[model samples]
Target: MKQRGGAYDPFDCKHYPEADVVMRPGMPLAMACTGEKARIVMLAGGRGMHQRLTSMGLGVGSEIEIIRRGSPGPFLIATGNTRLAIGAAMAHKIMVIPMEREIE
Candidate 1:
């Protein structure tokens, strides 16, 4: 079969869609883009009770997404089902998935 320009050919293992567009909004970004490893360093900030949410086992290292940004900006993170609301400031420091490869 013939393929268009740049489209991935699953059989060839040559094309990667993500390679072209690295980071994007409203989605989780790869750690490699941030130069951070599995262990990300971040500060706490968000809702007035953001610090309190930190202790809820949904901060740093956990996969999260930028749901929105504003005076009451909130994060829509997948921590089970509840949408975790993290302040934009804290989101800036808190990095997710480390780019380091796992050792065998």
Candidate 2:
């Protein structure tokens, strides 16, 4: 599917065009566009960080949306009913796969 950026890749979805571009795989959450939907692919932090995020329901495979992307500040993300304000450092450690989905 097509991500906010023009870079393209063939993802699992078949509904979108085969030529659709996706953001680079494993892009940091901090770089994700606001309102973009993505799935957690990997966590590039220590055990404590992993545990903390997992406890907050942000483990791998979790689907989330960017509510706010504040450069040099905390990023706000929504996963289900849970909203989290995460520091840029922490956000950078969270790798995600951008997804193309209708937001409704």
Candidate 3:
């Protein structure tokens, strides 16, 4: 196939009328995209970590938005009207499913 400017398309891609890309399954909170909303799928941590997160309203099934995916520091997330900064390790322990739209 040829693209604009008369450049040959090596892949020979064909345009589809209603092609949609599906998102992958749940991923770690630390790897979630900033500004994206997701639901807590699971927490990989034990009692202590679980309690700590739950106290901050990040329990399982909670819907959260990634405010900042801190690589070397902490992950800033929002749940309800509260915003909390969780450590990188803790963020990695939280598994979340990215949502296409916010849940009410």
RMSD of each: 13.4, 9.9, 10.4
The residue-by-residue lDDT of candidate 3 on 14-63, one tens digit each, is: 55222222333368898899899999988888999999987887888999
lDDT of 2 by residue, 1-104 (tens): 54545765456457754444453347888889999999888888899999999889889889999999978789999999989999999999898878873234
Pick out the ten consecutive residues of candidate 1 with the lowest summed lDDT: 25-34
Model 3 TM-score, 2 decimals: 0.71
Q: What is the lDDT of residue 8 in candidate 2?
A: 50
Tell me the deviation in Å of residue 96 in model 2: 0.4
Give candidate 3 regions above 4 Å deviation. 1-25, 101-104
Model 2: lDDT of residue 101: 37
lDDT of 3 at 100: 83
Estimate candidate 2's RMSD in Å.
Answer: 9.9
The reply for model 2, stretches above 4 Å from the true place, is: 1-25, 101-104
Candidate with the greatest lDDT versus the true structure? 2
In candidate 3, list every pair of residues with a backbone clash: none
Q: Write the per-residue lDDT of candidate 1 for residues 7-94, one digit (tens) a residue.
A: 7454444463554344422223222232232433343345643566566666544543333433444444445455555555555545
lDDT of 1 at 60: 49
Instruction: Please give the lDDT score for candidate 3.
Output: 0.81
Evaluate candidate 3 by giving its C-alpha RMSD to the native, one decimal. 10.4
